[model samples]
Target: SDKPNTIETDDSRLDRIEEMITNPNERIRTLENIIINQKPDILNLKIKNRVHERKFWRVSQILGRSSQTMATKVVGSYANDLKNSKIQEKHEVLVKKKRLLEGSMVTTPVPTQKAVTAFYAYMSKSENIPGTHHTLIFDTAITNENNGYHPFSGIFIAPEKGIYVFSFSIRLECHSYGPYELVKNSQVVGVVFSDIRQVCLQDQITGTMVITANKGDDIYVRTHATTSHIGLIPSDDNGRSSFAGWLILN
Candidate 1:
């Protein structure tokens, strides 16, 4: 009963069925041209016949595997590697403080209060040309909470193109110069000065450094001080200091 509806492929009925299923559009037209251009000799080519037989044998073997133990093993190993790759280690930083008791150890944290008293020269330019001035200054003075001094100053440069050598100075009234760090796009590029100096009484200190910049690149400086009178002036005399350099191809 199952063999009663078997369709034979070698008959002309198969050809009629193929013609009925074919479309008369560009794809069919292109295929017809190919079939006509490569006729009986093309259909009888040795390489094509061998390739077709090999492909059929390969498909038969794949179907005979019935779930394929080797294939399942390989796929399972790949999945295991992917699952193991997602495993991660976690860590925590201690933020609590401690105090000493008569006979026991007490843990506590000191309260932290931070406020920005003054900020100067916090400027940004969308159109930054070579040798142009892009200045950032902190002009406000802050009162120390519990006589604690904290002052910071720097210039941030976002340039379009060219090399730049930037130099500036900070002047504070009471705090000692703690540290000066140069960062390019949040990355530490240079440590201009790391030692403490008497920047309060001197009224001025100059810093000079060089850096290469590309299009849309930025450069800036920052500081930590004890007093509020600290300011980063780009020049010695009211933005008189020049940070000049050239843009070159690396």
Candidate 2:
């Protein structure tokens, strides 16, 4: 079994002293002063008439003080400096990222297989076909004005509109003086190269011409000299004109 002990206070002694004093009891004030500890130095008080409130002023004016100084002092303040810097950096980064995204969106992507196939088909359809291996010979013997030898004559017409490539080889046994030329629609397209040893006018002379022609166009190979014999078609050995190969239109 244990008994509780009580602690004594000086409140009775303090009350007795207050009763003897004529002036109002200053004990509560003194006790309050002691508890508060700090004294306001009123003699050293400064009257600050600046736009912002002082630090010692009431907290109610803090918002006003902050507002007043915000334009000038806030930029260098510790918390606001870092916060503003970070905010600006984030804004710049976001702007740069947005610009990069916009740039990427502007570029066109590679075409798909279907798109490429369609483009190729369109190009092929639009392009004209190229002509190949066309030959035309004329009968020169029909005129008979220049010796017994006949000259080559006649125009070969194209059935379809296309690019045409033609070649000719001419051989003469008796007359070396006569001239031969390959023509397209009566226009001279090519001539025999007499200077080249391989293309001399002795046994055979060959020439080539490439032209783009329309449908139903006439092309011919003609000779300057004339003869009674039709020299366009192949004759049996004696200066007879003859035509050969795939010259007939289908």
lDDT of 2: 0.45
What local lDDT score does residue 242 receive in model 1, on the 0 to 100 scale?
A: 23
For each candidate, the alpha-carbon lDDT, in order, equals 0.45, 0.45
Residues 202-226 of candidate 2: C-alpha lDDT, one tens digit per residue: 3446566667766666655555323
- Indicate the residue-level lDDT of 4 in model 1: 40
lDDT of 1 by residue, 130-166 (tens): 1212323333223222221112333333334444555
Task: Tell me the lDDT of model 1 at 192.
Answer: 40
Residue 74 of model 1, lDDT score:
82
